[model samples]
Target chain A: MSAPLSLPERLPAISLDDVSRTYTSGGSSVAALEQIDLRIARGETVAITGPSGSGKTTLLNLVAGLDRATSGTITVLGMRVDGTSERELAEFRAHHVGLVFQDPHLLSGLTALENLVAARLPFGHWRDLQAEARRLLAELGLGERLDAPPSRLSGGERQRVGLARALMGQPELLLADEPTGNLDAATTEELIGVLERVRREHDLTIVVCTHDPAVAAFAERVVRLVGGRVDGQQRLDRPGPLEVRSLEER
Target chain B: MALSGALAALLLSGPSHGYELHATLEAELGSTWVTRPAQVYLTLGRMHRDGLVTSERVRQETRPDRQRLTLTDAGRQAAEAWLAGGPADELVVRLAVARLVVPDRVPSLLGTMIEERTAALHRLRGARADDTGGFRAEARDAEIRAVEGQLHWLEGLRGHLGELVARPRVRPADERAAELA
Candidate 1:
């Protein structure tokens, strides 16, 4: 491992400079995101908000190394994400990034806890990942449901389990897309609170794409996307109900 | 009772004055909620006595003391329960509370509601198709048509979505039909 992290100050968790992504089909193309520039400092929580076709998921995929930029550059943990080979990118993500989705991809037959255990089985950190999975599940209030299969758990419980699996890798960066999309208000609040505590305790940098104002309120900054571009960015000061939008807009 | 639940749900964010709560409720629920100032104050007073909210008089330098209100732990729990609990008949009140409590989730809630109704409609039609023409067949078909109309209206909302809700990414008709089948 090159271990590029010994710099003077740990570099920003994520840096994107003039990035653009285009998809081509039938000799025509669609620009999913263009002229985007953003930087997320270490240990900060930022929320990405937007309507459909706004490239919110595209941005997350690009950061996670699941997709590549057509131009420009992406640097995460002081490593170049754009130009990295697929094998290198996979290796980097396994060591650094955690991903949570609206519908978590868990093995149907496995128990909640086992799902986590099996994720890193290929990498052979069985004991460490298991310990982390158990601790994370307990902390997330799913300790009682640890043995339940995915189908048996409630939507909220399953999402919490998804979070535990994400944390098992001990990743420094967490990317969640519509994490609270199917959750109830109380569950949403609880999950966001958990994320906040994890960020504080672990010094993890989080980038979440959400539609919920509560998520935006808890974030250090909110970056809004529109028509594949950065529409607005705001650093919040716990403005409570007004944090997401103004009274007039509501 | 719905307003009382709504009030409890609103304070889950934190503290607020009665006026601000009323204004926020009015803004969120819009014309559907026509609560008056006196009603809001009366309800707050009642909630204070019931231990749902704690009220304190915050003294301003240039003005009279204003009553500031905050939710008790009990209040928060009750609101959480109320926000997450609703039968089909209570959908309107429940959704209003959801919109007020978690504005970011309105679109998701709406989408879930629509899918559920559509599924119910499909079941009703399925039962009719396999029926032997019972005595109540006509009445049952009417109920099915009503649900179909509601589903149409809900689907229609997606087309004219505003800034608050994301415009849904509709799948191909064939895909949706296959899933439903």
Candidate 2:
């Protein structure tokens, strides 16, 4: 087996302590999340699943530093995300967090290569970034589509490119919001395979917010959000041995 | 036979090398089907000899040449035939034979079997709970239902066995002989 991607031994990738997010509209306040506490270890794959309006996206945003919690603390990669300044959060996001939306959000006019290279521009010059982007895209099975624009690529291919773009920053944590929502069954399976492979190869801590059970099943653990609160959490059993030898022995 | 037939069907979709074939089978069948590299090679050999598959060696730069396997017309026909046939009821066959030979022990045996099978199914269900793949989910659901049906049948058999035991039938010759001895 390949050696697991080494990470800082004890520091968690994410921690949420009594985190809550509330939105107010028309003089009525709605809790998008309530007193949520969660910890995700480094290099772990977790899926946040629930019905619509269940706070899955809200929780993901808090972790990604895109949205601040109304109450409680959120720490990701040892950074205080809950109350961090926008500038600090932006810097943290640039270096440590990669986000993928339901739509790939790739530029319509940019080629696949350009989209990835462009994402790296904020970090530095794009000259050396091209080779890394190309390699990442190739690893995602997009080598042949390097010059193809988002309009020309299939949904699965676009998602793969999105995934490639996420890796450009070499982010430790990858947060995807409904990554496979638009894909067909075959494409969904393909995307799952790609995600699993990429996670293993790069040792990424992935948290995908989705309602699809299939997508949730790919994760090592699943946390169910219900009505803006954590309803339950389940650790999915990895595929085990073919036969339970004890049964036969008996 | 299941493994060979599955391999043939996989080849019908597209030609693949040995390693790729093993990976594909694992993905398709999940952890239920345990296929070793040797088993894949052995099955390929048999199929090749039987004119069901053909192989061509493709040279690699840094490694030894690999053989890519493709299905023959006969292989395609055989795979279709295999798919057309209903699955064998192995559990039924085993239970029937066990009941004939050890009627007294059938209830206990089946009880153990049911308990084990149920536990296994629960584990499988938990493992596959989040799987979104259509083929994997459908296959898992079918297997779960089959196990449940068996459990239901076993319960009924246990009830009937209880009634028979309660009827107080005459002791068999062996039992009588043992008592006299």
Binned by DockQ into CAPRI classes (incorrect, acceptable, medium, high), candidate 2 is incorrect
For candidate 2, lDDT tens digit of each residue in B1-181? 6556656765766787777667644543456547697998898899999999999999999778999888999998876544433122334423433333334655656545544454444455554556577698777666655655665565456546666444443333444665898
For residues A1-250, what per-residue lDDT tens digits would candidate 2 score against the true structure?
A: 1244457743588999998899999999999999999999887888998778999999998898888899999889888886678999999898888889899889999999999999889787788789889899999999999999999999999999998998887899999999999988668767877887787688688999987666666677778788998876766544444343243333
Q: Residues B71-108, candidate 1, lDDT per residue (tens digit)?
A: 99888877766666533334565565565457676666
| Best candidate according to TM-score | 2
Fnat of all models, as shown: 0.00, 0.00
TM-score of the second chain, each candidate in turn, equals: 0.60, 0.49
Q: What C-alpha lDDT, on a 0 to 100 scale, does residue A55 get in candidate 1? A: 93
Evaluate residue B71 in candidate 2 and report its C-alpha lDDT on the 0 to 100 scale.
90
Residue pairs in candidate 1 whose N, alpha carbon or C atoms collide under 3 angstroms? none
The deviation in Å at residue B57 for candidate 1 is: 43
